[model samples]
Target: MLEVNHISLTFNEGTPDEKKALQHIQLKLNKGDFVTVIGSNGAGKSTLMNIISGALFPDVGKVTINEKNVTLLQEFKRSNYIGRVFQDPMAGTSPTMTIEENLAMAYSRNKKRTLKLGVNKNRRAFFKSALATLHLGLEQRLNAKVGLLSGGERQALSLLMATFTEPDILLLDEHTAALDPSRAALITNLTKEVVEKTGLTTLMVTHNMQQALDLGNRLIMMDKGQIILDISGAEKQALTIEKLLHEFQRIRGEQMGDDRAILG
Candidate 1:
């Protein structure tokens, strides 16, 4: 339901520090498609996400969602169709708001705000029921401030908030990167569950190789602002971490430099 066509971007254009973050990048994602993006530092992974989310506009070409061109749309305007969970738990949530309050706000994200902002009994029950699916016992903490939660708990709640409305597309920008191994795994599994349940088209940028492989139906590897490898179906099914690393070495004709991706 998303199409990125012939898009290109450069930073500090015509200056000494000028760098091309993306170049003639093209991608099309169908409804319910889940794509995992992988790359080393400065590989344009986050740049691509930003462009799609309207946080950055491409210097060339267009971004379309559901056949509507949104290349010139503002970030807030595009929030109606996009749900995102950032790398930092603190970024996606309001620290002072209670869990249910935060959820209430997210639920109203794309809707017209009414004069009444308070959560009523039915909305509170809905929030509790939704939080219960995380299986983190957060349903009992509806009134607890989100700041009181642990990193994993906050991230889990953030995930819940993002998917609560089932936005047309979900962007996960290394969402579990800041958590410990155990919490990362938990969030990863939860991500899969939520995506499957909602059938939300998704693009996830991850430094973790295993995570890239283990989730999503399509895998994209980018380098130097271009997509170097795109694997899916049978090719993706046969993929392994060792083979992926070898392929990277083959493509670059040099040792892969991102140690976090290699070690992950």
Candidate 2:
């Protein structure tokens, strides 16, 4: 349901600090396809996500969702159909807003605004039900300011908010990277559960190799602003971490140098 065609982006062009962020990147995701992206730092994983989400427009090529070209659409406009959770738990949520208020804003996404109050009796019930799915007891803290929550709780809430409406495409940019192991595991399980239940088309960038192998139907490896490897189906299923590392070394002719990716 999403297509990125020959997309390329550069920063500080024609200057001493100019660097190519993405080069001729082409990707396609069918409806309900969950693709996991893995790479070292500066590999253009987040750059690709930003381009797809409309936070950055590629200098070349186009992005199409459900046959509609959205290459130049503004970020807020794309929010109607694109759901994203950032690396930082704090990025997705407003520290000042209460739990229910944050959820209420997410619930109102893509819907025409009106004079009606944002949160009501029925909406509260719905928000409570949704929060209950996170199993974080946030349903009991609907009025609590989000800043009061722990990192894991806030990340869980962010995940819930992003998927609340089942947007056409979901972008997860190393979302669990900031959490401890246990909390990361919790969010990972929740991600799998929500995506399976909703059948949302997803692109998740992660430094964790095991997570990339375990979660998605397809796997992509990027380096130096280009996709170096794309594997799926039985090939992806049969892949192991050792083999993946070997493949990276083989294709790129250099060992993967990012310790975080290797150790994750």
Candidate 3:
């Protein structure tokens, strides 16, 4: 359960370059609710994610997880209960660490540190089983450095690491946008599988309209620093690319200008 209440943020406030990234944005996610977010460039998609993840503090309002205020919480402090996968394949993983080592670190999240080794016989077995679910043969290369893997492989590993601890909230910021279509599809399916299996509450930001519609039980479209549309249940299920575009035009009184969103 997460709540973002009347949060607003602006950069370079009162200056020539001042821009409002978010304005009185409000969102709430029930337990196991999966919401897909869509928007054109500068529509505050990633900005909203950053606010939730504690990478950026809002100028007003507050964020709460399970009814506890965390607006001022540092990103590291929130990491214990939040799992995130960035658009970049390299962002979420350690390039120099072995596959097993990276997984070991994720497995240790929120646990008290001790003198014990991060990886052992039991942990390795668990990591192997987990990696096997990716179907990428990473379980057999547990000793290999992450940098040597392909982009898709690295992203898959990143997804696994993010979900390994079963954090209360999962934030995916265009996690598959960097990969080829085939690989993107792979990661997308994996995302659906993992979320359903773990019942993890998730918020995913994506430019692809089809992807926005295909995944999640709910969908929201944002523009000009505000959430323009939020649809769920039957309404979300009945949505099509044409209907979504029409809704945007109807709400904003203008055409969607982002070509990527239109073609996606």
Q: Candidate 2's residue-wise lDDT over 14-120, tens digit each?
A: 99999899999999999999999999999999999999999899999999999999999999998899999999999999999999999989887889878899999
Tens digits of per-residue lDDT, candidate 3, 1-264, equal: 899999999999999999999999999999999999999999999999999999999999899999999999999889888999999998989999999999999898778768899999999999999999999999999999999999999999999999988999999999999999999999999999999999999999999999999999999999989999999999999999999999999998999999999998
What is the per-residue lDDT of model 1 for residues 1-264, given as tens digits with 9 covering 90 to 100?
999999999999999999999999999999998999999999999999999999999999999999999999999999999999999989989999999889999999789889896589989989989999999999998999999999999999999999989999999999999999999999999999999999999999999999999999999999999999999877897899999989988988988899999999
Each candidate structure's TM-score, on Cα atoms with residue i matched to residue i, is: 0.98, 0.99, 0.99
Q: Candidate 1, 164: how far from true, in Å?
A: 1.2
Q: Which 10-residue span in candidate 2 carries the lowest summed lDDT?
A: 106-115
In candidate 2, how many Å is residue 72 off? Answer: 0.3
Model 1 regions lying over 4 Å from their true place:
none
lDDT scores for all predictions?
0.95, 0.95, 0.95
Clashing pairs in 2: none
Q: How many residue pairs clash in each candidate?
A: 0, 0, 0
Q: How close is candidate 1 to the true structure, as a TM-score?
A: 0.98
Candidate 2 wrong stretches, greater than 4 Å = none
Clashing pairs in 1: none
